[model samples]
Target: MSPATALRRNSDLGAALAEARAAYAAARPRSAAQHERAREVLPGGNTRSVLIYGPFPTAMTRGQDCRLWDLDGHAYLDLCGEYTAGLFGHSEPRIHRVLHATLEEGINLAAVGQGEERLARLLCGRFPSLAQVRFTNSGTEANLMALAAARAFTGRGTTMVMRGGYHGGVLTFPASGTNAATLPLPFVHAAYNDSDEAARLARAHAGDLAAVVVEPMLGSGGCIPAQPGFLAALRALADETGAVLIFDEVMTSRMSGGGMQARLGITPDMTTLGKYVGGGMSFGAFGGRADIMAQFDTTLPHAGTFNNNVLTMAAGGVAMGEIFTPEAAEALFQRGEALRARLNEIGRQAGVPLGFTGLGSMMTAHFRQPLPDRPYAASPAEEALRELFFFDMLAAGIYLARRGMVALSLPVGEPEMDRFVAAVGEFAESRAALLRAGGIAG
Candidate 1:
């Protein structure tokens, strides 16, 4: 069916969802059938539960450049890009050629490889704050090490982080600072974007705080950027309290030339990174001051067999070789502006409140009533509507973060960007129609 016809019929989500199911059928009927068969062995029929949603998900068969092809051979402009790790885009030539070369040599080794130093050199050079760096298998492990080093350095038991700040997973920093129970150390979480409260709480635990860790932009908390001066205030509090500061830039590192903190001109004592650092492979790292990082030596073993695998190093070297160049950053920012503009325009015409959080290539959609009503309402209706938005977008050939953020990657040039804009444009109309039909209610 034509998009206009689908839009006309989808006056409510009940209808829109049915139309969405039809759209999915047209795109990957086989994938949906396969997903049903796989669900028996896999919880929710997926290795990653987040990938599962109503009407099922299309299994992507291949990705190259800025496009993804499903099992049924339907093409889509890949805006999600494996949750932002495909920053250089799928099968980037440099990374592809290098990984293939490395695989000929080996994949993982018990001992480190020369490529480890190559990737490390690029990281330290990119961020001047990093005097020493330690590799890990994922961002979750990186944050765990960051926290451990902070505690050891300060000899303090507690730390401060923002509420709704997502770091990584259980072995490290699972959930966010918002979920108080999961914090490994004595963590104090204050509402995000409120510098006054952060300062107050950090100071309250001043004598005991080892660090104040936060995301420069809250990635999972509805894509809300921290309010202006918020980060600076945390920095000051950390200094006054003698607490180490950490910037969990695993997601936000794609923003600036140096990282989000560099672009914002606010420096944290340490930073955690992963996701895209290994080209398209799994890799993670935490690095900071020479004195603090020395603890990672014999004093506290930062040793892990898989910390710096060989293949990831090769792919990462290629990724960094491309990323560290001025051209790569410029391409990211320029593309970012275009995507943001298109989304804003589409949402505006549809009478939807639309804006983005994060800088440069990492733009996440912000939809809801304007300020004074609270950016993220915890009401039941608001919660369900937010979840519903995600499923709707996916069915329309657009994937979104479980929290409704969208990360743009390198492969998305003009053609892919136009396709994405078209999807969002359809999303705007579909959402507006849903609201008018009482499928959604404030």
Candidate 2:
């Protein structure tokens, strides 16, 4: 392409994106007004950073099944699934019944409840790595406690974490720079999916490295799956360095009944759980080899007022035991696998530079061909295209993350999947020229 032609194409792409944003803003006046109102009390009218996007986010009114109604009264097929926390979907009858029963029984019992033991037993039985477990209020707290246990057990202070890994709000390590909100810890960051680099870092800091934390699949960091041999390498490194390997399965736990660790046959020293494990309620858990977790019993102090709250415990027990059984987990994994393949096939047939990466009911769309192994490799042009795609999908009554993430819920079946695929096909056909010009085409 000539310089003049490239310039013209870029101009056209800008206009196209501008037109989409204008249409998005025009269609949802009420949402815009609500955002303005929220800005009075909330910073950027948002508490969660990931939900914020340009032209403002459409404030959701309610969700039923797999559908959500925005403040403007537009109904959408909810593909975001609350970032994998809504695996059971909105209005799961089993969970609701359990929650109602728990509420009727009473909340804030302020005592050790039988529900905690039931849930813990269920978790330990399902996941092989969990010889013993402790609960928390969220995944962040679960990871924090897990790291604390590692440090206490190993008698070391430094942690080795993967770059672009997100353990929690305060434990995030992006590919570049640092998150101001990140907890102040002695951390040595290594590239994701690069086992050699991880090994080197672990060996270099072996003496002080208490834990090597990693996500089986980078969740918020674009759903990039760990390549073959990557996790095994980390396992070996942890053994050699005497560092506790902590797998952050907060998001990827949905990959199987026992999580990615079980699915891949690589057990970590410690594992953290959250999201759907709470039956869509606030919950988190960290557990591992009894020997390491024994520190909590003796030296380490792990305490949270709501850690054993009856509601989460009751719902989680039912969620794992009754609702999302081992069979259901496997079925969802197959469903997601088929959906991802179909989406990629559509992109290929359309000759568009769009694809999805992820494993089993959790995936992220990217406006780039031959998707990179890490988030930092995504280009700014691709990001612009992703933003445009977000608007397009929203207009078509499909809801996903602005960052192109999709977490399929139990309520999302064949019909919803078909609609999503059709929407993607339409977007590819409509934006073929712009996508190609953005240099994302193969």
Candidate 3:
């Protein structure tokens, strides 16, 4: 395309996005009012930064099965699935029953309950690495404790992390630099999915390295799965260097009943877990080699006010043991795999610069320039296209993260899957001209 043509196409794209943003704002009057009211109390009318977007976000009023209804009366298919925490769907009956019973029985009991032990035993039996476990309030806490354990166990201060890895809120390293809110720690950032880079970092910092923390699949960071053999290399490196390997399965645990470690056959020294493990409740857990986890021995000073809360214990046990059985987990994984394959196929056929990256039950769509010989990196144009796609999906009655992330819940059956794919097809067709001009080359 000529420079003049490119400039005109860019202008058209900007205008189209502006019009879409207006349509989004106009569709949710009630949500706009709610946001205004909330801003008085909550900063930016949001507690979670990921949920926020320009022109305000639609306030969801209720959810059931696989759907959500915003305050403005717009219904959404809820492909976001509360970022995988709502794996059981909004109104899972088993969870309801357990929660009700636990609530009636009272919470924060002064005594240890059998339910807690039962849940721990169930987790230990399922995940090979988790010989012993400890509970926390959220995935962030789980990761925090896991790292603390690694440092204490290895008697080292430095930790190696991927550039795009997100362990917890304060433990995030989305890029080369740690965010201001990141916990103070000696961290060495390494390129994700690059076994060579990871190995080099591990060996270079061998003496100071306490742990190598990573997500089996980068959930928040564009849903990129670890390259084949990358994880095994990390396992071998950790073994060679005496560094603790911590798999932050806070998102990828849903990939299998035994978590990703079981699927990959590469067990880490420690693992952090959260999300639907708590049965759609507030929960986090970290556990691994019994000796390393033993640092939390009752004789030592370690505590969480609600670590053994009765409701979470009871509900989590049912979630893992009864509700999300091994068979159910495998089924969900298959469904996600099929859906993702179809989506990618459609994007390729359309010759749109759009694609999805992820493993079972989790994925993120990106509008990029083209496949690079190296690891994927989003360009500025791709970033704008992603934001535009978010609005397009929202208009089509699908709810997903602004970053185009999607997670399949058990309730997302064939009908919902078909609709989601159809929506993406429509979006690509509607924006074909702009996409092709931007190097999509359809």
TM values, all candidates = 0.88, 0.96, 0.95
Residue pairs with backbone overlap in model 2: none
Candidate 3 structure quality by residue, lDDT tens digits, 68-127: 999989899999999999998999998899899889988778788998899999999999
User: Runs in model 1 with CA error above 4 Å?
Assistant: 1-11, 18-28, 171-184, 371-375, 378-396, 436-442
Scored by lDDT, the top model is 2
Q: Write the per-residue lDDT of candidate 2 for residues 372-395, one digit (tens) a residue.
A: 677575677887888888999999
RMSD in angstroms, candidate 1?
3.4
Better model by TM-score, 1 or 3?
Answer: 3
Clash total of candidate 3:
0
Per-candidate local distance difference test: 0.73, 0.91, 0.87
Question: Cα-based RMSD of the predictions, in order?
Answer: 3.4, 3.0, 3.2
Better of 1 and 3 by lDDT: 3
Candidate 1 structure quality by residue, lDDT tens digits, 1-442: 6887766555555555555567656766788888889988988888765577666777888877777888877676677767778787776778878877878886656886788898899988887578889899988889989999999899998977665667775522333323433655677767777887888898788889998888877665555676548888888888899999999988877776578777788878999999998887989999998888888775988878877888888888878776546567767877887777777777667776544555567666655434211135444434444556665666666655755667888767777678767877776675775544432222
Model number with the top TM-score? 2
Model 3 residue 255 CA deviation in Å: 0.8
Give stretches of model 2 more than 4 Å off: 1-11
Off by over 4 Å in 3: 1-11, 298-300, 369-377, 439-442
